[model samples]
Target: MAQPRKMLLVDDNDESRYQLQTLLEFAGEKVVTRTCEKTITNIEDNLFALVINANSLGDYSLETITEKYPHTPIILVDSNKNHPLIQQQHDWRVIGSLALPLKYPDMMALIRKCESFKPEDLPSQTINSGNTEVLFKKLVGKTPEITKVRENILQLTDSDVNVLITGESGSGKEMVAKNIHYLSKRSNNKFVAVNCGAIPSELLESELFGHEKGAFTGAMTKRLGRFEVAQGGTLFLDEIGDMPLPMQVKLLRVLEDRTYERVGSNTPIKADVRVIAATHCNLRKAILEGRFREDLYYRLNVFPIEIPPLRARKEDIPLIVQNLLQTLEARHKKKIRLSSTALKALNDYDWPGNIRELSNLLERLTVEFSNQLIDAAEISQKLKQQGRITPSRIPEARLPEGDFDLKELLSNLEANYIKLALEESDGTVSRAAQRLGLGRTTLVEKMRKYQIDRDDISETDS
Candidate 1:
C-alpha cells in the first residue's frame, strides 16, 4: 500500500479547475487546486509529484516554474496540441500534453506513467567549474584510457570545432558527444542528436535541413530541422559514415558556409550550430572503397577522438557495474548485488557489445534475480546463452621458407601471443602479462609498439 501522490493542478478557469480537481480527488489523489497567480507563491513550500498546468499563467512564464523545480514532472493542458507554446516546449520535464477537457482514460494513463519518473533519469545541467570529471560523471570509469578521453573533452570545451568521434558500436560515442556539448560554451541551448544510419536517405536531407509545408508528397506542414532546432547549440551526427554521398556533399557545403536552405525554400538560413559527428566505421577505409568522400572526412575530423572499447578497460568493470546497479535500483526500486565471483566472471569475459551489452545484462539480471546475490555460475550460464563464451587457443608461430623478414615475423609472433594471453585473461594487463612471463609495463610497451588493442583483437575474433 502506497500513499496517494500529491498533485498540483494549476488552471486559471474556475470551472475547468474544479472539474479536474474533483476528478483527481475521486481517483484518490491528493489534489491541490490553485490559480495561475497563486500557484507560484505556494509552489516552494511543498514538493509535488506532478504539476498539471493549463498553459494560462498570465504574465508568468512556464520557464520560471521549470527552472525552479527542475526535477518535477509537468503535464501541459492546452486546447491546441500544435499551439506555439506546446510545439516549442523543449524542456524534458514535460512528460506529455493533453487537449483541454481531458478524457478520464487519458488522464489516468498519464498519471500511471508519471509514477515511473525517477529523478536520476533526468539529465543534469550543472557543470561545476568546468571539471571534466563532473561533466562526464556518467562515463563511469577510472582507467587511464577513459581518463584521457575526459581530458580530451575538457580540451574541446572552449572551442566549437567540429569533433569526429570514432569508436566501436556501444563504445559510448554519443555519450562523449553529449559531455562535450554540456561542457561547451553552448551548454544552455538544446543538444540535438540525429543518427545518419537510422534515417532513410531520401528523408535525411529534409530531416537535417528541414522542409517547407509543400516540399514533398508527405510534407504536410513546415517543420524545423535538426539544424534549426539546435541553433546556438550542438548537433550530434551519429554514424556519419553511413550518410549517403549526396548528403555528404551537402553537409560539407553547410560545414564550409554555415548556411543552408529548407528543401522547398530558397532563403538561406545561417546555422549557428556546432556539429559533432561520430562513426564506428573506418572513414579512411571507406574513402579508399569510394563509399565516403575524402573532403567530408577531413571537415568532420578536425579534432578526432577515438574511444577504446570496454574490453580495453576491463579494470573499470566493477565501477561500471556499481554505477549501473544504482540506476537499476532507482528505476526498479529493488536492490541487487553481485557476488565477488560473479563480478570476476564478468571481468573475465569479453564484452563484444561494450557498455550497452553490460547494461542490458544488468537489467536482465535485475528482472530474473532481484534482491539476490548473483553468483559466478549464473553469470556463466547467461553468457553461454548469449553465445559469448568461447575457448581460447594458443597461436603457433610458423616459419616461412621464402623471402620473409625475420624481425617482422618475430614481432607478429609476439603480438599474437600477447593477444592470446589477453583473451585468456579477459584483458587484465597484469594477468595477461603474468601469463606471458612479462612485466606489466613491458607488456603495455609491446602492445603499444605493435599497435595492438582490445578492439583489434575483438575484430580478429569476430
Candidate 2:
C-alpha cells in the first residue's frame, strides 16, 4: 500500500491545532503541526502535500507562506467564510478557504482534492501555432456564421477594446468570451466571469466592486469583488441586459474612468482589466423601453459579436454531434456512434435551446445507448419524449442501399441489449444476466467479446 501523505497544519491556537491534528491522524493522514512563531526556514515545503493555515499570524501573513513555498497549495481557515483575509489573498497557490470549526467530511474531501492536484493542471500561457484553429474548433462549425465569429475573435486579439457579444440564450456567448481571453495577452492571468442576471441588485455592487468590513448588514468582513480579482485580466459580464438601471450607471462610471472604489471605501483603484459583456436580450429594445440605459449600451457596444442561433446553421449539426460525442466518450469511456439516418433526424429539428440543449440530449442518449450505434428511430423516440419533435416531423430510418454484414449488425444489436440490461439492473452482472435470460458466465464472455468492461458499467452507476 502507498504511504499516507503528509500535511502541514499551522495554527497558533493549541486547542484548534490539536483537534485538527487528531482528526487528520484518525483519517490516516500524516499531520505536521506548527505554531505561527516557527521560522519558515525550519519547514521543508516540498515534503508536505498541502498547508492548512488557520488564523493570521502577526508579521506572518498568508502572503509570507505563499512566497516562501510558491509551489505549495494552501487552504485558509477562518471563523468567517467571507473573512477579509480570504478575499485579500488571490494568489493562485491558494486552492480554497474554509470556515472553522471545520466539518469532518468537508475537510477530508478537500484534503483528498489537494492530494490529487498536479502542477501541470495550472493553466499555461503557451499557445501553439494551431491555437487559433483549436479555439475556433471549440465553436464547432465551419459555417459562415461561426467562421465570422472566429475572424472577429482574431481581430480582437491585437487590441484591448471592450467586447459586446449578443446571442440567443445557450448559443455559446461565454465560450466566445473565453476564446478572446485565451487568445489575448491576458491569457496568463485570471479570467473572472460574473452573471449579472443571477446576482440580486442589492448585492451586485459589492459583488463587482467588493465591500469593506461592516459596509452593510451582515457584512462581517471585507471582501474583494470581481473587478479586483480580475485585475490585469479579462472580466466577462454575462447577461448584461438584465442588469438593473441603478447598477448600470455605476458600471458606466467605472467604464469611463477605468477606476472604482470598494463599497465603503473612498479610495479609488485603477481598473486595468478588459471587459467583455454578453446578453441574449435586445439591448436597443431595452433602452427604448427605459429598462436599460442607452449610454451604458453605447459604452459596452464598442465591438459587437452576434452569434447565430443553432437553427440558422442546421448544416453544422453533424459536426457538432461528432464533437459532443467525442467529449462524452472521453468522459464516460464508452463510444457512441450515430448512423446517417440519426444525423438526418437531428439536422431536421429546430434547436430552440441551441448547443446547450443539444449537449443535454447527447448526454441522455449516452446513458441510454452506451457503446451502441444510434439510429433515427431512437433519436426520434427520444426527441418525441422530450416534446421537441412532433410525430409528423419524425424522420424514417432507412437501411443502407448496398450489401451489409448481417453478422456484425446482429452482434451490435446483442451488445446494445446486454449493455441496456446492465444499466437497468444497476450494473450487477448477475442481475443483468438474469434479465437477459443467460448464465452469468456466458454474459461475462459476451461483455468481453463486445469490449464492455466493469469500468463502463461503473460509470453508469455514477
Best by TM-score: 1
lDDT by residue (tens digit), candidate 1, 1-462: 865558888888887788878888887788777777677666643444555554677787876766666667777888777875565434546666667777887777677666766665554322333322243545767788888887788789779999999987778888889878866778756789887865667889999999999899989999999999999999999878878899999999999999999999999999999999988789999999998999999999999999999999999999888877887787788878999999999999988878877876788899889899999998988876544322353336576787988988888878877886766443546556767889767988998998877544331110
Q: Assess the local accuracy of residue 192 in candidate 2 as a C-alpha lDDT between 0 and 100.
A: 95
Model 1 backbone overlap count:
0
- Rate residue 33 of model 1 by lDDT: 78
Q: Model 2, 140: alpha-carbon shift in Å?
A: 1.6
Q: Which stretches of candidate 1 lie over 4 Å from their true place?
A: 1-118, 122-133, 388-462
CA lDDT of every candidate: 0.77, 0.76
**Model 1, residue 368: C-alpha shift (Å):** 1.2
lDDT minimum window of 10 residues, candidate 2 = 120-129
Cα distance off (Å), candidate 1, residue 355: 0.3
Best by lDDT: 1
